[model samples]
Target: MVIPPPVRPPRITEFLKPYVLKMHFTNKYVHAQVIHSPTPTVTASVSSQEKALRSSMGITRDVAAVAKIGKILGERLLIKDIPAVTVFLKRDQKYHGKIKAVIDSMIKAGVKLL
Candidate 1:
């Protein structure tokens, strides 16, 4: 007998659309910011394109790149005395993969996800 695939419940974001802070790191660029949240609240962020970690890591792909961004974000949080924060993994329709690696880095750095 063949087994059927399990059905997953709709994502929380699909309904709640929680506030998201995100950053994108690529071979040549890094963009970071907060999204869908209230105004006047600056979600301190950093990225490779900001010249901080853009050239810090030689390898830009997979876990290497993800680790670099995680370090940057962690540093920023540390400087602000923020012990932990909720993170929304944003990859524009892409799930798991490198995104998972990035989230892992955040967790290791002491981030609390909602």
Candidate 2:
């Protein structure tokens, strides 16, 4: 009997491209990070839970808070010389509500989303 070859898992670089923009939302905070796929390293990150952000935000988790996190993340990425990224939304999160708010703020902050 002939046997089929085993399938290999796809490389993160194969689909994640050069860099990935990751976002996560919890009941109490929103977080975002820019990762370099090849090196598998986080280049920049921001969260509503950060002490400075929290002090400025008052409300830790909300669309506004998420937007602030996104804007800050985008700025950090820019500072790190990452101008573009592929957005990776965690789990079953949809492109609405806080997610949309974050993405919009990122775009406004001048980070190109692929």
Instruction: Tell me how many clashing residue pairs each candidate has.
Output: 0, 0
Model 1: CA > 4 A from native: 1-19, 25-27, 34-36, 89-94
Best by TM-score: 2
Who wins the lDDT comparison?
2
Name every residue pair that clashes in candidate 1: none
Q: Quote the RMSD, in angstroms, for model 2.
A: 5.3
For model 1, what is the error of residue 67's alpha carbon versus the real structure, in angstroms, after optimal superposition?
Answer: 1.6
lDDT of 1 at 18: 41
TM-score of each: 0.60, 0.82
**lDDT digits (tens) for residues 24-75 of candidate 1:** 7566555555444534365666565555555666755557776667766766
Candidate 2 TM-score over all chains jointly:
0.82
Please report, in order, the local distance difference test score of every candidate based on alpha carbons.
0.61, 0.83
